[model samples]
Target: MTKITIPLDNPTLDDVARHADVSPATVSRFMNNPSIVSERSKRKIEESIRELSYVPHAAARTLASKKSRMIGVVVPSLDDALFGHFLELFHSHISTEGYTTVVASSGYSSDEEHIQITQMVSHGVDALLLVGLARDESVYSLLNKKKIPYAITWATDDLGEHSCVGFSNHDAAVKITEYLMDLGHRQFAMISGTLKGNDRASNRLQGVRDALARRELSLPDELVIEGPIGIEHGQKAFKLLMSRSPRPTVIVCGADPLAYGAIFESKVLGVEVPQDVSITGFDDTWLAAHLTPSLTTLRTPQQQMSLLSAEYLIAKLKGEDVDVPPTLGVDLVVRESCSSPA
Candidate 1:
């Protein structure tokens, strides 16, 4: 028998059927169970399949069986050690349940997160865990449509409809700032992660603003600088804030890295921490206590959030009814970094 020539390099089922001179159903039947098809048809179908290289999706069955056993996670960033520690506990929990994690860092872009999550779903993730609840609505819609179990993390208020497990950024910030206010600190400067596309940062910033407003003290627009949550950025922000006419008496950082930078820069600038300017951080990462003056920051329940989120998703995957956990709160840990103005 002569082989058929096809222009299309990546042919579909129809191409195989046409080349074989059989219906698409016949091709499917032959591929699924070659013994059921007549010898004549099988010969032609085999030849057509080889010539056209028509690839039938093999993963379709895996998706139907839900055997991928992979959980997808997308975080705002991986640069923060907080996420690293979070993932460590999260992966440990899920892995023990016979699931592995596939993590993606969106670099705090909502659009990128949507695209990455959609790709993960298309790739047949059994479940998902996302950071914050600030992405496109389509992301949630797609998860629902696909019936994929997911948990929205990093926020205390589940916002009524979307039940989640996380600490309140707003409340945590308020706690730290109020403590500072109680120490008679009035001048406030904040070094924050960019508020754009990041609901946590936005909420924390609002918390500071709210606390300042209540105290009859307002942070100048210039005193607050938003950038990445890295030490260098923190140092730059500290330098800039210190250069202002009336330097900040206290600096509130959105993350521990920023607070670390403020303290480091304080040393370099011949300024004393707590004595010259008080500092505080959020997401009390492990390094917070190791700093020279130590760090006063709000402790995020990373390990608890990770384990609970893992259990929540695993229960959903197993078809077990889960009690949606209430919103978690943060604790303000007083350390050497903060003191009243001298």
Candidate 2:
């Protein structure tokens, strides 16, 4: 007797269709939305699939029906607290709508984002959610070629080419700056993430510029330090700022991470927050509230934004016209870290 090996190729939809004596289209329809299929046929197809333990190919079904019920979300960094919040909320919302989410990290690199987008499309994602609009041309070209439903989050534009669901970083930052300015903060220093590839950071920097411009004050190159949104970066930037001839009385951080870094550095340098030097951060993360001196920052709807973005994209995927605006709004949260300039 000869022993034969059975390959684990996984049973496809064709096996279910054959067992049920129905066409592949019917099986596909039943899998995507069983409500559309007749009760008897659905039962038969499902039973057959269970008997064979069939697992359908995502790509084949998508090619046939032009849908995958899987939404892809691409973000800059997954290690950050904000992005982690985004992933959690997005997953919750997507699951509620009978859809799934696939997340990919771009690591703050356009090339990396492009590669991730390509891989996502190949995996048969019904739609895509990008962190910001700043990406390589190849990304847009691929989206166009595949006609994928995509939405830009964390940033927005006036144009209605695609759906956008987030607040304007420029406006939010300007509001925060204006609030600080009203407290008599004249000299300013900014510890910002690299603005070259990140639209959110760039827009925030522009808002800072616009805010200063209104007061007839200008931000010089010396006052701005561009680096990673890390504690180490913030510490180095703060040290460099302190070395200036006339140091800034207030420091504005691009994100909460940077703000925390600045605060840590200030403490290490024998400076008291809000007493020796006022500090403000963007993205009112939970850590911001839990810090020794709670960070004064803009309250962005990170979780809500994630849910709304997923809802809008899923609606678009289902051929429903969603009336989501281009930009969501943000609020300002004043906390212990910010006060009248010393």
Candidate 3:
């Protein structure tokens, strides 16, 4: 194949059209309304642009279309695999639709989230994706005042006015707790993520409590360990739980990372999983199935939720009618890590 390189200094739409064997008007249509462009033409235009290394002028595109073609996303943190996987899928889906994504981490702080939202708005993002609905009311008001379309992920509330695409954390947790109860495991200890300003974490903890209450059982204050989400925290929390006079038969972790840490610590302490004490975790991450005992976890529909959230935001930006976002479901993945009380 002959190498073709267009001048980087001044590559124009006409040049792109000539290289792609299409008219200038066709090139403009492909740039602005890619949805209407045929697959053949789309491929040609894309290949030509890549070959020539053509860069579109953002200001010109914005002026012509009256859109920034950018989406802002704010999450608790990107340190964990769960959030990282969701972001990867979400970004991939939106990029195909010609929209760019900008992400910010709140470090699990609502105040920091407010600041990030303000910065994204100042940068002129056309839409936004918030991880959860636990943000302050002022954050919503800010988006409303700016007329920016947005959606919430990680948890769902149909009764709420805001658009959200996620499953019920409370219900999922309840299901897992009931599963443990069915296995004849009575004593329960929970290693939970910090619940402050995090509806997902709080709801999960509540679900466990509700399930335990129905069984005439309660998670004693001494058995509940709430801390930052990390492997080190999980290890320390597991050690504390095991040190109790009457240790729990099974431990439920709020997230997979914590569960992984607990499992590792159990081995380090010469305690066998499911033989010594069973364990469960939420959000079945990639490593969940590969662990020594294979973690029992709830598989949250992160990929589907993220894809739907991106689609909702894009539709709203394009002035299309969008129905109420659907509430996704979670699946209980029974693995080797969980079993009847030893």
Candidate 4:
């Protein structure tokens, strides 16, 4: 059994052309614009690419065509499966149109996000997909100055002067809270993601507050727990809320992971879900439906948002007259985890 080994140095376009028995110019044309290449040449080049495992130098291609054929995406964190799903959909949609995605995480910091954005731009990303429209003013300015076609995801703020492909976090939260209120839940507590630099988290918190205010209820300082990302943080926050003298009959988590943790912690504390307390979460992730008591959550249109954002950016890159991307909506998924408070 003989093993085929590729050269230590990368295979170049010239090598692919040689293997394909075509001129280097023909090979370049086939790569840059395959539609212009003849069928026979296309087949040959593709076969050569597969046989040699030839990878194009993005930098060289960008220099020749003035198009990087790359899209940059910066999200707050990748720990959430929701973000992973979004990336998967976004990547799949754009890949069909000859674009690749590069992703970076900001750890939920605006400054860090700014740096990542700058780095992506410097590396010659054709466009950017940002999580939200709450970054530093300079970041926006930088995009404008560079004339980069970028879109915001996970939030739809039409008031902002940018293209966005997401739903209103505030409205989704309101829907969840209102539903709980309708279920006769008055004593409410919240386990929220850190709102310091996250507009999504801040908006969600405000949504809960606004809904409570409309019902002549209030979210007391003690009932609100600002938590970091993860199940452990959710567990700790739940414990703190449950420790209150008059424990909340209902707990609203900013995301599903927190709600999952809360449910687990409830069992540990000998509290029955929906009997002693009702719990609700945002982002109807895959796990939400399979929990012991299926979680009541907001079903965000993550796939739709990602697909539209990718398409919008690609269209804009092609000098198309792209309109402001439509704001997708969320659905309220009522499940076993939430019920009338006892």
Q: Pick the candidate with the highest TM-score.
A: 3
Clash pairs, candidate 3, are: none
Which candidate tops lDDT? 3
lDDT of each: 0.86, 0.84, 0.89, 0.88
Q: Where is model 3 more than 4 Å wrong at Cα?
A: 1-8
Candidate 2, which segments miss by more than 4 Å at Cα? 1-31, 34-60
lDDT tens digits, residues 1-342, model 4?
Answer: 122345425788888887888888998887765657888998988888888889998878999899888899998989878899899999988876678899999989888998899999999888999997777789889998999999988888756777888899999999999999999999999999988888899899999999999989999988989868779988999998889989999999999999999999999999899899999989999999999899999999988898899889988988999886667889999999988887
Candidate 3 residue lDDT tens string, 214-284: 99999887888999998888999999999997889999999999999999999889889999899999999
TM-score of each: 0.81, 0.84, 0.95, 0.92
- Per-residue CA lDDT of model 1 for 1-342, tens digit only, reads 233574676788778888888888898766544557898998988888777777666576365454576899999888778899999999988876657799999988888898899899988898999998787788878989999988888985445667588878888888888999999999899999988888899899899989989979888778889998899999999999999978889999999899998889999999899999999998888999998999999988888899999989988887898876877878889999988899
N/CA/C clash count, model 2: 1
Better of 1 and 2 by TM-score: 2
